[model samples]
Target chain A: MTNTNRRVLLKSRPQGEPTPANFDIVDAPLPEPKDGEYLSRTIWLSLDPYMRGRMAEAKGYAANVNLGDAMVGGTVGQVIKSRNPKFKEGDYVVEYAGWQSHAVSNGAMSMKLDPNAAPLSAALSVLGMPGMTAWWGLMKIGKPKAGETVVVSAASGAVGSVVGQLAKAHGCRAVGIAGGKDKCDYVVKELGFDACVDYRAAGGNLFKEIRAAAPNGIDVYFENVGGAVQAAVVPQLNDFARVPLCGLIAHYNEMQPSPGPDWRLLLVKRATVTGFIVSDHFTDMEGFWKEVPALVKSGKLKYREDIVKGIDNAPEAFIGLLKGRNFGKLLVQVSDDPTRS
Target chain B: MTNTNRRVLLKSRPQGEPTPANFDIVDAPLPEPKDGEYLSRTIWLSLDPYMRGRMAEAKGYAANVNLGDAMVGGTVGQVIKSRNPKFKEGDYVVEYAGWQSHAVSNGAMSMKLDPNAAPLSAALSVLGMPGMTAWWGLMKIGKPKAGETVVVSAASGAVGSVVGQLAKAHGCRAVGIAGGKDKCDYVVKELGFDACVDYRAAGGNLFKEIRAAAPNGIDVYFENVGGAVQAAVVPQLNDFARVPLCGLIAHYNEMQPSPGPDWRLLLVKRATVTGFIVSDHFTDMEGFWKEVPALVKSGKLKYREDIVKGIDNAPEAFIGLLKGRNFGKLLVQVSDDPTRS
Candidate 1:
């Protein structure tokens, strides 16, 4: 029990794009579980675009990571010691442990994960927060009717992949917008999207490309990227189109206030744009957990994860995520595999 | 039977804000009703902020006014002569007659106005398009729940006035944002809003002022003005707040693209902003006509109109509307009182 915990802590606020200088890797004594608390060792860490927002001083759904604090994140871990009666030792659980090797959590903070039923890492990727985000966003906000067209940006990533697949299962023409030909190919062929658009392709305007892809016009735009991508999709939206705004990765690093032509275009199209956090829909998790697992089992839903080898690389993987470098749900393997335990 | 018709035709598109020079006064021989047609002599011509969008070349809900075409508008008029069985001479009706002294209408075009029941001008103001805009926006989009806070911009204008009254009637706390102290006073005292923020008097920091006015946060924002007003209102929006965007008068006349911090802030709030055209909601008019009239008759709703004299002055009145110069529903008295007919 003499293990030392190493973690990345926020060193300073980022001006625009976060640099390595903004983070500090430091060592601390591993936390021991107190009464009513559990000592959890991190197994897999989730790195997401939303972490970029958490790094900023501006107001967002979650508080910004304060200087000298462990960067906030969702982690899948194994409880090694539990003083709480509800959680037993060796139980795999999901917890908000930030960018740390080990954590002390109260029973209230963790959801037990069943590794025997599903892949243990899937709890931090497809079957977890990212999966739930797509479920709630598509089912609740996007509300894609049968035969409708749904377009998602960053389509090869965790949430977008799930969004596209779920939309397909709902009888929609799922269109994926990804960065490169490889991701686009994967989204279309592997994820079963009706079509995929390569946003990085030269000589093709996004609006023109999307318009060509969706002739009847996009019914739902699962907005994860804002900027030129949003501008392109807005005008092509059909009357009463719904935009489930899950993230704005494009402008997360922007130091200056965003320049705009105003959002009057959204108004003129008679479209709806709404933002949401997955936690806001937590009350409906009973319906989500019940429905999603069945979809996964039936192979109606698919997910992908970009796994990093160690906790030390989580910061770099997170930085890559903000730049759209990750091909799937970004996760960091924090410790040795538990199956050998 | 001999009538001199003075019509305002679109002369040229204005570079910025519209001026009197952008329109031309044309005289023509009054048209006669043909088979199944009726002649309508304009009584009150409605002037609205949306007309500014019509004057632009940009694609919008309706086709932009072509040069040399009569400026389109809604008018309440008298059927002076009828060749149609459905309409009779001397019957008051509502028609799309543009800014004109007289018009010839087919039986398919006019809705019989209840002259004895309410002011015929009411058909062009509160009981017609503006009133219906408020009704559909509140009922369909705003969905004002009991105890929710409803906030509207341009609070003394036709749509805003109706929106406030309807919100109050639904047992919500209604807050109004208007330009002047008078309009603010009128909205709170006369229209029954819980409070009103005078945006102009507050030195344009409407965000702070609105927050001070609605400490509970805004549930519904009836957006007519977009720009700083929208920027200010967006942050104060409560979770699941509904913004029924009826107009963007603030940006309508500007030729250059509006510079800004991007509207992507809309994505983080989990709020919905949707645009609507009243004409698109025409299918629901029977419901509106039935409910609104009852509310008006029961003294639960009140309306106001600013009547400008003469058809020749419609262009000036319309220009004034874009500047927020009109206190209520701006209308032109196209002909002498048809109630005396």
Candidate 2:
């Protein structure tokens, strides 16, 4: 283990798409575990679309990451030192440890990880925030009934993959809107989605292809990447359709705000569009932990990770994530996972 | 009483807004009631903003008014002839009697009106579709809590006026948006809304005026008029805010569909925006009738109607209504109300 903590800090807020100049990497002395706190070596750092909102000065659902601070992120780590009675040396934990090699936690929101049940990194992917997001948003908000058509955007990504799979489990036909042919293939063949529309390839035909894919019209739309995709899906929404708007990654990088779908469609269709953040619904965590991990263990749910090596490459990889360059749940492996063979 | 039925027919669909050319009035023979049917002399014809949608080629919540057909409308009439056991001569009834001096009804959605309980025309305004629309949309969808601010557009109009009063009754701070000074004054002084912003006078400062009116930020927005007012109100919505999209009167006359407010605001506020039409929720009618009419009788729920005279003048008054020229619930009194003093 390194004696120094290499941390990436927010240098500036991005006007549009984030560049490497907006981030600053520096080596600092490893943080010490004070009384009732434990220091953990960050093994995996999750790069999510929401992190883009955190870097903006605009008030989002959550607070923005202050300038010159370590960029906030979800992390899976191993405890190397401890001062808290609840934690011990060598204990694995999933916490909001930010973009660093190590972090000190008072164990407020940190959860103890069981590497034997699933890979430690899985806690940062399918078994973690993204998975629970899909479960809660789809079931509670989307409310897909049997024989309904459920369509999800960014379908190959962390949250969306689980969304499509869960919709299928609920006896709804799951259709996916993805960026490329490769991702579309993975969403349909590997992830077991009924069909997947390649938005990149479809170009002007996106709406037509989506309409063909969701022949009976969309009953529940799991909105992950909003923009042109949203405009297309909205017109085809069935009467009393539910839209669980989890993310708007398409607009996160824009310099100016874009207009949403014509609301006349909502009134005509009697649709329900709800915008939500998973953090506000933490009360569902208990139920999620009970049901989701079992599904992951039984091979009912599948997940993919685009793992980038080293913390130094995180800025570039994150930039790629916003542009749809990375497939699946984008993550940075800061160090080796001891549980992985 | 007139021996001929002076019916208004839909000559053509309007391109942007309805014109006199779009309608054709003709004198036709008075219809006889069939075995199960009843003939009535039309006393009041309710002219609502939703009629604009019915005249359009685009598919709205309900079916479009077919060309050459009598323009559909809600009416309060006195039954002059009856073949059905449910009705008797001189009995007041509220039914879809169209834009004519007389009509026949088989009693599908027709409601028996009691002039003694409240004014027979009250069934077409305060106790009818508009009142029920305001009641259901605000309570069921907006779901405003005590100490929260509820803002509604089209403040002095039939639905919006009732929405503000109901919001006030629910312990919410009721703010309204109307077109001009007179309507704004009537909204605040007579109907008891906390404040009313004049959208025509506010100009570029519309949002500023609205923000000032709703100092605590809007928690519930009963959307009766969309477009600029919606764009202005959306930014001030607080966390977990609810928006019951009841109408888009502002966009109803447009040749092209206008864009809705930036959805990013919805995401940031975690708002629930649901679109609904009162017709779909007729089950609420029983509860509404039991509760709302009593409020009207006690003078708790105030109402006003802008009554125009004669069946030949219906087209002009309807055109004026679309332009916000009518002050209150716009209605055309086709014939004398014997029940009225």
Candidate 3:
């Protein structure tokens, strides 16, 4: 086996939108697991918007990824060797392997993944962190009841896609807000969202379209995109509405202050807007893993993956992610998936 | 009886700060009680910031008041004539009687005020809607726990004054934000708050003072005044903090857009900001009336009333309330309190 390992590291903090120069791909010798540890090979690396927040120097919900350190992320991997009784050779696991070709770990922070239960790549996409983010925020925070209208922004992206579907399952009229007409169509047609508003059409008409779709007024806003989309949604919220704030993807690249409505509007509606990180409520994770997989297996829940081939394309793919270029859950296939192959 | 009733009506909607021209004092013939109704005379008229929102053309949580309608408000009055068996002459009651000398009401919308339990005028202040507003928002929404820090804005106003006192009772560290040095002094020295920051001291140092006062960080913010006060408190909120949004008096006279921090800050701390109206949770009113007055009577709760004599002064008093010129709950004595006189 080739003993060469490669990693992508943050070269410098970004002022606005991140460019390739802010990151550097470096090669090193492959790491080996000692006693009571396991060696894992990365198969799929998840790319999410929250990664941008981690790249900055500012303190956040999590620790900032230091310059020259591997950009942090979730990964679906194959365990090649195991020194502990908890694992064996040819086993799959979900881990925080960061942006690397291979990793050596004791498996304490990793969850064993079952390839036969669903596709192995699903662990990095729908069946993993991003999926949990959508579920927890919508279920616990948004809490859209029957007959209420639920609107999800960035509707074709990983978290937004699942949020809209969950809103549907909860007996709500689901509306999607996506950047383009095609993504909007996919959200409405494939995901069965009640309606999808194309935000890229015209800034002035976006609210009108959303208003038309959710005639009852928005009861739950699963906020994934910030800026104009949130500014539009704030006025449309119903009294006693709930907003589960997940990500501010639109503002992730923004250098200037984001434009929002007079926050007095939130007071006018008696609404609840909460900023939440799923990690704070991981006790609910066990329940999510049990419930979500059953729904996915029964075709009651649908997830789409926008998979890019090879580790070399990760930087470009992630850059495109912030611009809303990729649809559904964005992931990079760093190595061949043995189960799929 | 003179049989002449004095009333204040909305004369014109102001573009910014409301002036005397926006209100009119006129005398009209008092209407007689019909078969199912009773005639009542206003004794104490409550002037609150919410009335400013009702004067505007835009619709809000409640319906907008038309130009010629009597300015809506809560009033403590004595029934002069009763056609219904539930009420009798000389019995005191609290009702939404507007800014008027007389009211005709069926028993459905009014609560019988027990003068023996508390002072008749107390029904219009601490024992009334303002008191209930403080209790419900602080309990149901803010939910401050033991040792946690609680901050109440508009610290010397009716709702905020009670919010800070109640925070102390609940074993939480109570901090306040008021407009003047005197008000800030009264809040800490007289009202039992741990600390109070004067928002009007200077714009540059208000946030610094608030941060210093709440050295442990804020866990619950009872938001009565929005604008800069809210923007300052946003950075100090702890993870999973709650904000009970009751009113935005600081922006009540604002003609231009009110400035607040980009709300993405709410997403950072995983905090909850919920807007609430006391009217929505009136069932809790019974509990508030029972618990709060007991606290007041036992000296556990301290209340200050800044009462102005004559209904003619209500317009100026209300304007002063908006500017934080009045130190405590601002009310107008419309007539002799029959329970005392």
Best TM-score goes to which candidate?
Answer: 2
Candidate 1 local lDDT, B1-341, one digit each (tens): 55778899999988899999999999988987899898888888999988888888888788889999899999988888889999988888899999888898885767897788888888877888999999999889999999999999899999999999999989999999888988998898888899998888887667888998899999999998877777788778887788898887888888866653355566567778788999987876886877899898888899888989988888888888888889988989988885754
Better DockQ candidate (2, 3): 2
Better of 1 and 2 by DockQ: 2
TM-score of the first chain alone, every candidate = 0.96, 0.98, 0.97
**Residue A271 CA error for candidate 3 (Å)?**
0.8
Which candidate leads in lDDT? Answer: 2
Per-residue C-alpha lDDT of model 2 across residues B20-138, encoded as one tens digit per residue: 99999999999999999999999999999999999998888889999999999999998999999999999999999999999999987788988888888888888889999999999
Which parts of model 1 are misplaced by more than 4 Å? A339-341, B259-261, B285-287
Residue-wise C-alpha lDDT for candidate 3, range A1-341, written one tens digit per residue: 66977899999999999999999999979887899899888999999999998988877789999999999999988888778779788889889998988888889989998788999878876777778998999988887789999999999988888888888888999999998889989999999999999999957998898899999899999988888888788899998899998988888877665645676788889888899988788776876877788889999889999999888788889999999999888999999887885
Candidate 1 docking quality: incorrect, acceptable, medium or high: medium
In model 1 chain B, which range of ten residues has the least summed lDDT? B259-268
Interface RMSD of 1: 2.2
Q: Lowest-scoring 10 consecutive residues by lDDT in candidate 2 chain A? A: A282-291
As for TM-score, the candidate ahead, 2 or 3, is 2
**TM-score of each predicted structure versus truth:** 0.93, 0.99, 0.98
The lDDT of model 3 is: 0.88
Cα lDDT tens digits, model 1, A229-260, are: 87788778888888898988888888765764
On residues B1-341, what C-alpha lDDT tens digit does candidate 3 reach at each position? Answer: 65988989999998889999999999999989899999999998989999999988877779878998889999999999999899999899999899988989987989898889888878777888889999999988888799999999988888898999999999999999988889989999999999998888858887789889999899999998887888789888998899998998889888776656666678888989888888898875776866798899998888888989998888899888888789787888998885674
